[model samples]
Target: MTGTRTQVVVVGGGQAGLAAGYHLRRLGVDFVILDAQSTPGGAWQHGWDTLHLFSPAPYSSLPGRPMPHQPGQVYPDAAHVVAYLSDYEKRYELPVQRPVLVQGIHRDGPLLQVRTDSGTWSAHAVISATGTWWRPFVPAVPGRRLFEGRHLHTVTYRAPADFAGQRVIVVGGGNSGAQIAADLTGHADVTWATARPPRFLADDIDGRALFDTATARRRALDNGQADTAGVAALGDIVAVPPVRAARDAGLLNAVPMFTRLTAPGPQWPDGSITRTDAVIWCTGFRPALAHLAPLHLRDRHGRIATTGTRALDEPRLHLLGYGDWTGPASATLIGVGRPAREAAREIKAILGPGHRPQG
Candidate 1:
């Protein structure tokens, strides 16, 4: 396959990229997903070994396909997720070119040239679904660089056994911080630090409720009604088994962020410094848009501006799964499908009614 013939080129091959490919395939649009990884799992394949979807199987699935899970099980782990994504591509026969690292994209008169390590993919439209896992952001404290203790972002963290018998500070208020802190409890003395007080949802309320609330919020916004419901960022942390266990063990509590870093640990404003062996920064990620730098699609905040799934400036370029700017919960497995289908539809509409590529 060559760049001159393909109609759409989807980037990333993660859940967001897969969802977009599914919709484009249904339309018979000659498209291909460029995946940097050798295998089918997106960031999930690179996630922590114990990572599981916060939502249940029903809500965590892609469009048209229910993720295969144990009959009574609700959440599937990282390995299970990778298997499902691999099978999904085979089931739909989605055109995915893996082990291909896309370097950049540029406008070439009528077509967009997607330059990659293997070759350039010239297409009428390009959908970038490259997610945030590659770009983790850790806030800088005054004396952070002076600390000699070991430091790692969530991207490099995997097992708790490595930190056994040590005092660890897990930073960030999101689910990653909570889950990692919980995992470290038995192995290490853990202190959960957050920019603000960590909010925990009721034990029974899970991701199902979070998705429903997001849906309702989207509906209200679509209808132009002011509906401020749950927390702005999905409903707090889901009460996963591990998190619940941590709570029961009195390890789920969070403390205010430390003022600065000491040689061995973080120092509070009260002049008390707690000795910390390691710091696991579970801080969230920024949008990974380095490949699109030549396109100049980002703002000062390093965000690609989009109206729904469509680019605010370039009509043929679409960005999926970055965040709410693309669609409601656009980064999630379930949420990504809506923007994917919409982008495919818009591409077909722009290219005329009969632009079918040989499958």
Candidate 2:
């Protein structure tokens, strides 16, 4: 394990990383991509095999390639998306070095040192496209040490098959929890606990209510009225009023949130209690930037600070797939295209055309 040097290094081989790599390749910049996974597609590959993108193919495709599915259809299963990413790399010949976990990133004089499990890579600039899903967030509850049933984070979940005939409680109300609850109803006694339920949207027949919800949140954020607390209080802004009305009509019971988890079971705010055999924590994620101590880049909330879609620490570092950057559009595929292009353009200006590295 010797050290390698490059002009630029992109971390994480998921869609965002690949998008950056693709643009860098076209620009002929000298760059390398480092990813922890054995293959590409990031979290998508680890998700349940049957999972498909909520977005249609038209909106899900990356810059240079069309999604392999019909334009308006639901994107294929995880494997298909994985294959698409593989096809993308092969089709464009992007340089991706996989199975490398970035251990630390530090400033080595004018250049940056990226330490991986294999070795160190030196680059003038680094694009950290590692999205926010790697870290599973399970809250610390009182007496959690006492109650012991099989508990796991949503990140490790592969299928609902194991929960069959078992009583399961899913914590957190994000898409993962909601989907898990809906999926488990047939085989298991499932109870979902969320501090605040997400605003669930109906299928395409209801149109882009999800986008509208995003827009409202964006408006709130722009007004400086919505922080983490604000977003949580707002509930599912993506679902239409009618959908909420319909949901209230008894598709599912939205229980009052749980107040505490005793050793035996969880106690809800209503003074009632329920027992569970297992708990699936779908609580959100924090940044996977723990290895980046050398740069000292973070906001007051302990998140990587971005300036107009670029990291404030350096011109070469960029963050994509964040739900709230410039606005509500920041996290979506179409929304990320502009920022990705801009990052490429700036890196190309520094490295020159063809993404070719400087010797």
Candidate 3:
């Protein structure tokens, strides 16, 4: 009963979207995948050059393909990862309709309507595999506009050479900040600002598995330390010092996260100021669901309500890659696959072949 329709529509073509597409194909489901980027790999292709996932190779690989590295080896680079995603797309022949930015998803009677630049399409079910980094988190630091130098967010960061010889301040203690600081320190004067000096972990430390910090943090959170210990202690965000250890080597200075960024630079708790030529905000990201206004679905924290591992409340709407607040695996490359596969299975089971209305 439609001019254009699919059994399932997957929004996003990153690792999560690709994984969902792969499993949907395996189950003999009819589906279409959509991505905003010209190609796949989502935001990975656009990240900083020195980036290798914090997770080891084994933990980062997708469902079927091997990562071409030893289990615990650090991944090659961003380009290599992007190439692999491209290969994944070709191997499975996932029907990814790309360069088609999805504007929104709304219900057209009983059918879910996906609005895109090309046209509107209807689907029995929809899987949104959009990653956690939907929107870059840039705070409104006062006097930021007064700064004369070129300011950029981590989203715009591509390589270290661009910031060479520049005085750069990285504002965050997460993995991204650490990695960027490590890379920039070799060529630029880099300063890292955080609320507290994080207890750093490495890919491996002292030849032993660096699992205790994460395990302890998780246990504490589960035991109701989520609120009491606060964001600094939870270690929800990765605080691993980069392999190069730029902070330890004095190439980068770790400053306490302070309040009020002045025209001169960041102000610390102890009446100190750090001057910088440029500031790269590694604050974090928030989901951009402004397009989902019609759905009227939200959680306590103003995020879209999702459960059953990204399975949405509406009969046809589902979510993927929403494990941001979950466990260690929630936001990792390999972590997204489970929810994606489950969404595909749920779509297939709910809308078996004959459910399609006659034209």
Best-matching candidate per TM-score: 1
lDDT of 1 by residue, 1-359 (tens): 34545889999899999999999888878888999999999999888867888877777889989987745557888888899899988999988888999999998888788999887778899999999999999887788898889999999999999899999999998899999998888889999999898778878777667766777788888899987763465445777999989988887899999999989899986889998898999999988888888888777877767878888878889999987778878888888888889999999888887875432
Residue 103, candidate 3: C-alpha displacement in angstroms: 0.6
Query: What RMSD does each model have against the real structure?
Result: 1.9, 4.2, 4.2
Those runs of model 3 whose alpha carbons end farther than 4 Å from true positions after fitting are: 1-3, 70-73, 202-244, 310-312, 325-328, 353-359
**Tens-digit lDDT string for candidate 2 (1-359):** 45788888888888877778878777767788898999777878888644655555655677889776844345456677788888887888888898999988888777788999999988878887777778778899765666667778877776778888988887876666666666566678877777764566444422133444556766666688845443334444233332334345554445556777777777777777677788888777876777676677876788777765567776656666665663355455545555677777776787654444444
- lDDT for 174 in candidate 3 is 72
lDDT of 1 at 230: 39
TM-score of each: 0.95, 0.84, 0.84
Which residue pairs does candidate 3 place in steric collision? Answer: 194-257, 310-319
Count the clashes in each prediction: 1, 13, 2
* Quality of model 2 by C-alpha lDDT: 0.69
Ranked candidates (lDDT, high to low): 1, 3, 2
Error of 2 at 16 (Å): 0.4
TM-score of 1: 0.95
Number of colliding residue pairs in model 1: 1
Over 1-359, each residue of candidate 3 has an lDDT whose tens digit, in order, gives: 12468778888888878888898889888788988899777878888877776555555667787666634445456777787788888888989988988888898887888888788778877877677566888888766776666778888888889988878888887767777878887788877877667456433441112233434555676677754333234343343445356655766567777677777777777878777788888888875555566777876778765555543567577766655442334445666566567677777888776565333
> Which of the two candidates, 1 or 3, achieves a greater lDDT against the reference?
1
What is the C-alpha local distance difference test score of candidate 3? 0.70
Q: All candidates' lDDT scores?
A: 0.85, 0.69, 0.70
